[model samples]
Target: MPLSEHEQRMLDQIEQALYAEDPKFANTVRQTNPAVHYKRWIIKASIGFVLGVSLLMAGVIFKQPAISAVGFIIMLSCTLWGLSGWRRVVGGAEGTAAPVEGKQPRAERRGMMNRFEERWRRRQEGDH
Candidate 1:
């Protein structure tokens, strides 16, 4: 349900207060894009994958089953982590294509609920 006018006004007041209290934090929150976060996650996963591969190789060379099992687990987890958000990063970038002249951006065109639902659906599909 949509917020009442009074609620909207209250929310606006709260946001303004936040900005006044800490402009830096407000700006950071405003400018934080989900895709950037996902990209960072992908980068971390890549590093982990490399580390896992190295560990696996070391385990094999040293003939240690326990070490090899740990390496395999790390590799699996990293692969899943990298895969999970791969599509969101790509899709989010694609969805952010420049708007046509005199047109609003895609992000501005959709309601917050619509965006949330879309993200939820994407997550469900990704999990499968």
Candidate 2:
């Protein structure tokens, strides 16, 4: 239901008053939006991933095994972090059903592998 004009005006007035009373608090509350937070995470992770790539390249050029290893670790961790944030952002935007835990049977999970194995077995028998 839409709010009445009078109610909307009143709500706006209250918001203005609140902002006037403490703009800092209001700004903090506005910045606390989940979407914004997730976006920041994604951006930071992307930067870290780039940095890792540079480190890995530099390590290979300098023949420093330890630096290269550290760079690889940074790249892996950053990719995971960024992907997680991206999933949350996309999921929230789409408002679709989330994946249920422990709902599928083990056979169902292995269905694709089973099909591949069956095909291989048939091919092997036919070769004789």
Candidate 3:
């Protein structure tokens, strides 16, 4: 559902306050393109995977089990990171799936936490 005018104004005020408090961070958040960000991570993960492979092979040649184990761990972590980034990029490609203007996922998480806190406060008050 669309936000009411009052909600919109409140959001605008919050945004302006954010900008005033930290213009650099605000601009960084504003200019970020999710696709590009995830693609960069994917690239880094690809590089990490290759490095892990090389490490694994070198460990095998040098007869070091610990090095081999570390390399395997690196490979697994890189695979996970790449897969997660790929999933996010794909999921966010849809226009309808995009969040409302000026609303970040972090804000949704914060709102959920706030609701939980409020409920806890009410429960405590009722117990008194």
Candidate 4:
């Protein structure tokens, strides 16, 4: 359901509180970029296809039809691969889901030594 005006105001207030208290922390928490950020897989495949064509020319020069056939296969495979990834690249960031949102935000807990030191400090200061 869409938030009512009152609910929207409350959410905005909470966000403001978070930003005011620790803008740096809040910004850090929001950085959930995908590890597999698409960097033109299709472009890479095009380059590979070009290289395959070059290889085919080399094979022809060397008088090896077998090598030429292999190069042709390589070119075909690369062209197909490039075409397959074309749609994904065009879809952009919205197509890919943020990794952090779907799963729990895993916190690295304080180790035993850190806890012990904290306890020791509190005791010396005469506080719990």
Candidate 5:
């Protein structure tokens, strides 16, 4: 879905703030995260992999040794093709999130211990 106008303004403000703080890093962040683009790629590649492999295996079963080699070729193509998709998943692609002070908390705080532990976790041990 497209961002609403209010959201677009908020994003603009955030970009301004980031640019003020660090122009270079802001440019880096502006580069769309690869993760956001990966799901479509994975799906397409997966389809191609399945089709290629299936055709190859079918060729092998028909006793047509000539096209049987084509089956291996197709299998190899799918293997490599599917692997590229896997590599993209491994690359840690994700949807663009609202740029914020920190990653959103995993969950709501539930106890005093949680507070203390979380605060400790956020702090550098050497600072004390």
Candidate 6:
């Protein structure tokens, strides 16, 4: 259900107070893109996966079953972590954002996934 008018006004007041107290934090929160956040999570998981592989290799070289088992567990956890975020990124890509009723410009109204992919593409182009 939607907020009642009184509740909406109260929420607006609270938001105003937050911005007044810490505009930098408010701006950061407002500009945060969920897709970028998920991407970072996936990158961290990838690093974990690499570490897990190294551990597994070390276990084999050193003949340690316990270390190998731990490495397997780490690989499993990182795979699951990466998969969860990958699903969100893919699902978000297929979804569209509804434009807010007021204030925000069209350029600023793109979906989170769209914005992230655009940034990725730009970086790729710059790299080449």
TM-score of each: 0.65, 0.52, 0.64, 0.42, 0.38, 0.64
lDDT to native, each model: 0.82, 0.81, 0.82, 0.73, 0.64, 0.82
lDDT (Cα, tens digit) per residue for candidate 2, span 1-128:
24569977998999899899999999998677677788898999999999999999999999999999999999999999998899787654343554467544332455444656666777768952
**Model 1 lDDT per residue over 19-62, tens place:** 99999999999999988999988999999998888889889999
**Pairing residues by index, what is the TM-score of model 1?**
0.65
Name model 4 segments beyond 4 Å from true: 2-39, 91-128
lDDT of 5 by residue, 67-126 (tens): 656756766776676666666755423323443465443244255555565566656454
Total clashes in model 3, counting residue pairs 3 or more apart in sequence or in different chains: 0
TM-score of model 3 vs. true structure? 0.64
Better of 1 and 3 by TM-score: 1
* Pairs of residues at least 3 apart in sequence or in different chains that clash in candidate 1: none
Error in Å for residue 58 of model 1: 0.3
Itemize residue pairs with steric clashes in candidate 2: none
Task: Identify the leading candidate in terms of TM-score.
Answer: 1
RMSD of each: 9.6, 19.0, 9.6, 15.0, 12.2, 13.5
Error of 6 at 7 (Å): 6.7
Question: Model 3 Cα displacement at 40 (Å)?
Answer: 1.8
Backbone N/Cα/C clashes per model = 0, 0, 0, 0, 2, 0
lDDT of 3 by residue, 1-128 (tens): 34569977998999999999999999999898888999999999999999999889989999998889889999999999998899887764442466767555533446444666666777768953
Report the poorest 10 consecutive residues by lDDT, candidate 1. 90-99
